[model samples]
Target chain A: MVVNASQDDPEKARRFREAALPYLDDAYTLARYLLRDAADAEDAVQECYLRAYKHFDSYRGPAMKPWLFAILRNVCRAEYARRKTAPTAVEELPEGGDQTPMWNEAPETPEKQMLRRFDGDTVRRLVAALAEPFRETFVLREIQNLSYREIADVAAVPVGTVMSRLARARAMLRSAWLAEQEQAK
Target chain B: MTCEEAEVLIHALIDGELDAGHAREVEVHIEGCAHCAVLMKEYQEIRQAIAESDLRYKAPLELRRKIEKALPQPQPQAAPSRRSVLRGFAMGSAVSAMAATGLVAIVLRNDDEQRIENEVVSAHLRSLQAGHLIDVVSTDQHTVKPWFNGKLDVSPPVIDLTAQGFTLIGGRLDYVNAREIGAVVYKRRQHVINLFVAQTANTERKTAKVSTLQGFNIRRWSDRGLNYWAVSDLGADELSEFGDKFESAMRANKEG
Candidate 1:
């Protein structure tokens, strides 16, 4: 008898696969955004699944998305530290940036046409451009559609921090979208 | 609600995170306020654009298949040995460390030893990352020793030197030379000394070889059909001393 038996138990493994495998795409998306390298992202996702499986029996959460994502975040974070990469590059909103309606002064393009401009690649690029904690918050909200409470649990930050981060993330995203639109003109 | 009061709530409102009373309050504020209305629309459009863009990366089919196949089971296929079973223990952490900053694309070319050293140093760097310094966390050498019994081909020598300057922190499996090996972790002050041991087919009198790579020093030696590599950012003299202390402790245990 070993300290860990679920590893050798087919039933537990099956349950874990059912609970955790459905979110593989979600996990990959987060990892791809965090690492920005396909190979590295795949490696991180693999590590996340392995780590999650090892501790699957201990998991008692209602949802598997956040729990699995939390594991993935740590894996990518370790990669960041291992590479000794620079800290997340946070872009500050300019003075009165959000005070004025950010999209107000743009040349009068139809809202429909303007939004259609945000193609998949462009949207992904802008989202990826967001800094850490903020980028992570934005992805969890807009992409994964996790509730703020779930996000707070996954990120291990206070609910207030998540709210403020979402606010900042939205502001940053809007401003970045406007800037990109302006450049296109 | 004042514009200032409703400003922060708009995000929650857009996400439908707000309660009925608060959501109504934000709705009231936006109805009366044009600026707030525009802001709300902008946020909604951003969310919509992202959704329409379909940015979620579906895990590739190969990746899905790979993960499904690798899930540990009572009788799993493709995992040939304990080494593969313990491979996850070794790759427990994603890698980033100060030493890894200087890692450029270096061609190992014809030197197999050089390639192995690079990988060993890389594993050391990865283990330094937080939340994964050790998989089996214990200062007790007794507990740490047996953890690798079924996980690895050979049990690595886990020496407890809490009485000495170095403290036996814990142990984890680390990938080195393309095999899952045991890494006995110790800490001297703040520095981590990772002792990686692997089984050698042909035992030879390989004396202690000290080498420095990527801002870390590795002191390696072999004994009784096993190879050992102790890597740390600790000074060469100090790490070598740790290696010496460990070797004697292992010898004394074997003899006595």
Candidate 2:
């Protein structure tokens, strides 16, 4: 079996590998959220990394995560755009109580909080309930600890927008979470 | 002092975006202002919850590995002979140009800055690999500064940027230009600027040049034996401004 010319450049290949390593989980997470399907998310991530590697020379900074994320975000957008007309209903808890306000619950001890963990299904539903922008901001800021500026850079928005979206995202998440408990009742 | 102002700034304060003076003011207000304080705590708690939530699903490890394996490589045929390397270079340049224009169009037409920002992100990664990342790690500048005394013949001045909307998150010993260097880490809106500092041997750190390599903006300058390279995915103007502010602060502390 012969390796192709594209696979021969180990340095470039390693650069891509290393750069994509730390951020693979993150990229996948973002893609999963955007596509709402594991396979599509995986595909999106794979495509995004390839797109990123080809254009890696255009990147000139110390951090690779945000840049890779930016690429992943673009790939997700492209995928989403193609499937724009698909009849995917935003998931909603039946007989909803506006939004999940469980986020308003007072901060509890970390251990107690773990005991109160929502099931995977509930968490999925709650994330699904959020508007795309809010969901994306929430994931990048809350899940990834990306700076508002970095989120803004990745989302291609102003930092102010990142904050607002995050706030709204939290608000929506809180409502969705509360709705989950209500449904469980 | 007002509740409205406090609310807008509360998240900023928690994120450490406020100046020291403003932070102090916010801290003082939070002690007396019940409603504003509650709101602040709520936001923080909400942020914490979101961070902990499994709201965003993790991509399977196998998928991640497969993606890594599929990354593209540069064409070797383009760089085969030294004499033909120039021709290869010309073709490569043209290809890159076309790719650049197409990419910019894709990114801009998508009305998303995230993809365009990756250009800066690549530069940020390059700096991380240039040498060891930092020169200090102690919470106190005093400890960090003294540690570099003998390691570097001319010590690069170290001052905390925490007060000026840049929190001195940490520091590490780094290598640049075949010499031991200092890298001070700071966070601005969560974007980490790994500020690489080394004594210029003798040159003043005044002339600032912002260069974008692989999309990362590197603001390089020399001031009072300290050569500073503020590398981040941050835009040119912001990095340049940050370099200016940092240089001034370093200079002022020296005079004081």
Candidate 3:
């Protein structure tokens, strides 16, 4: 509830609105994918904006997208932990051995055809199913189209980590997607 | 470039994050290597599918309005800023402007009441925490009553009602609707009751309405240019009975 004196500047608030409001949809989209809940995404976006306004003076980052996204990521972290303990999200698939997907399956014609035939809902589901770091990287690079360096700014990781996460995320998505297509056939 | 190096750079290349040198190298690798080429094509398709999909969840209009309302407004200063002056000029014709917008005088009473109830209930719960319930702890209304003088815009009525089963506990300042209001505390058996009083424009009296919220009973009424809400875990009947006795004492003091 403590209001910083700088946050109360009308001129500053005006400048913030001009600079930040245009990305509400983008922020909302990132939040929705991150949280997987509509109401939580809305709240996260609102908190992100409020915090951004509070720290508008301190923001000298690369661009507005990464800056707001970094704030949104911080906000979603707590929600993610809370969600992990919640009964709804407790059943996580175990990871090891067979859990690591076999990727050497020959690219049958059907898998390639399915790759070419992009269904919106199916793509969204596969992306949403990805675990963190990967999910976040994919959404930033593919959906929001942020550069890897920009994503690293938001994710607080090295550019190399962003590169690896993006590559791994794409591989995971491709395999999961191709597998799903194989199943449907 | 080797296929291993090209694999790391393919996504960057597709996303146009790579410089021309790296992009051309990755393209050259993909040209001869069918495996890397297929992987590149699949990654491209995935990115394209996501891009073409209608997955961006636009914030609801209500959320925008809610956030706008919640943000702190710039406090008007001694010498009004130009924006404030313009705002004042706009407000000068607010009635006409509001009428034009067809929202001249529609305050949703239910929403306001619902919001206030939540705030007061939250304040009551917070006060229950250790060292938070009272600013001035006293069993005498005389001491509790004077503690609020000059602190608030209006002096809340603090009546000693021990003889009527509710014992004077203490009082404190609590916040509601973004303003500090007086809270007169009392104890009924083991239950604590907070009587929140705030200044209101309504001079007319409204009968006490008892409502249950979060397992706590609240009896709210507006009278004599002040609004009152008595919140407690006591049963509804006992709480309203306490309200009646307190009102009678207030009336008796006024008449005498």
Best by DockQ: 1
Q: Compute DockQ for each candidate against the true complex.
A: 0.29, 0.20, 0.28
| Model 2 chain B poorest ten-residue lDDT run | B103-112
lDDT of 1 by residue, B91-177 (tens): 323112211533121122346556567778877876764455788999999999999887777778788988768999899886564
Sorted by DockQ (best first), the order is: 1, 3, 2
Please tell me which model should have the higher TM-score, number 1 or number 2.
1
User: Regarding lDDT, does 1 or 3 come out ahead?
Assistant: 3
TM-score to true structure, per model: 0.52, 0.48, 0.53
Model number 1 iRMSD: 4.8
Error of 2 at B165 (Å): 55
Compared with the true structure, all predictions reach lDDT values of 0.75, 0.61, 0.76
User: What lDDT is reached at residue A153 by model 2?
Assistant: 88
Q: Flag the better candidate by TM-score, 1 or 3.
A: 3
Q: Return the TM-scores of chain A for each candidate in numbered order.
A: 0.80, 0.76, 0.82
